[model samples]
Target: MSGYLTTHILDTARGLPAEGINIALFKIENGERQKIAETVTNSDGRTNAPILPAEAFEVGQYELVFFCGEYLENHGLTGGNLKFLDDIPIRFGMDDPAAHYHVPLLLSPYGYSTYRGS
Candidate 1:
């Protein structure tokens, strides 16, 4: 099987899939953010497929931008005017391109968590 980069989003406050949330994957190059791909969470709060294929994975810094504000408002978890957080961005690194990277997000209107997943 080929290696890949994958992600999932879960709304801890509501205990459901964070559907419809927009997510972006970016690479940090020369102190600038270069977008690699963009995807919106499906009904299950996951990408349709792996975000990065083995051929695309590289050893470098990366970022995942989660559209938390819009997601909360759309799901009635928060009002549209809420400002606790807008687009929350998580930055991490891929030290080994040959391995799979599963980045899962556990999110709430007020906070979020992420870690290297299987």
Candidate 2:
């Protein structure tokens, strides 16, 4: 198998996949940030393609910023009424380039959680 990065977003409050949300992937080098790729979620709450394909995989610090606030607003949730979590930034690292890294976000308006998935 080859190494790559993938992601998923689940709207825990609605108990459904978060469709049409934007996600950006970035590579960090020397305290500076570089945009690697960006994609929007499909109906399945996943990007149409891998954020980082195997051939383009690299070893370094990375960040996945989710447009959670916009998504919440689009879903008809008033941000002014409930504002806690927005534009969630999840930073992680990858040292190996031959293993699959699945980063899934379980999200809510007030809080969220992520982990290095299988």
Candidate 3:
């Protein structure tokens, strides 16, 4: 099997899947960034498909930017003008071309956490 990337978001404070969050995937090479994929999380807090499909997978550094501010605001979970958390970007490297990369975000209005998931 070849490598691919998947992700999801859970609203920890709400104890539910974070629906309708926007996410972007970018490949970083030579100190520059190039967008590879963009999708909105579904009702299950997951993209419809792999952000980086195996056919387009490559071994390198990548970033997943989660647009959390709008989601938080839409759900009435944010402050008036200043958001403690907005767009969250997670950067990491993919070294194996045949492994699955599952990165998930646990989010709240003021903070977030991520880890490599299976």
| lDDT of every predicted structure (CA atoms) | 0.86, 0.89, 0.94
Candidate 2 lDDT over residue span 1-118, tens digit each: 6799999999988999999999999999999989989999999999998999998998789999998887887776645766567788899999987889999999987788899997
Angstrom error of the Cα, residue 48, model 3: value is 0.7
Model 1 clash pairs are: none
Better of 2 and 3 by lDDT: 3
TM-score of each: 0.91, 0.93, 0.97
Looking at model 3, the pairs that clash are none
lDDT tens per residue, model 3, 1-118: 8999999999998999999999999999999999989999999999999999999999999999999999999888896787889999999999999999999999998888999999
Cand. 2 Cα-lDDT:
0.89
Structural RMSD, model 2: 1.4
Better of 2 and 3 by TM-score: 3
The TM-score of predicted model 2 comes to: 0.93
Residue by residue across 59-101, what tens digits does model 1's lDDT show?
8889999878877777676645656777989998888757899
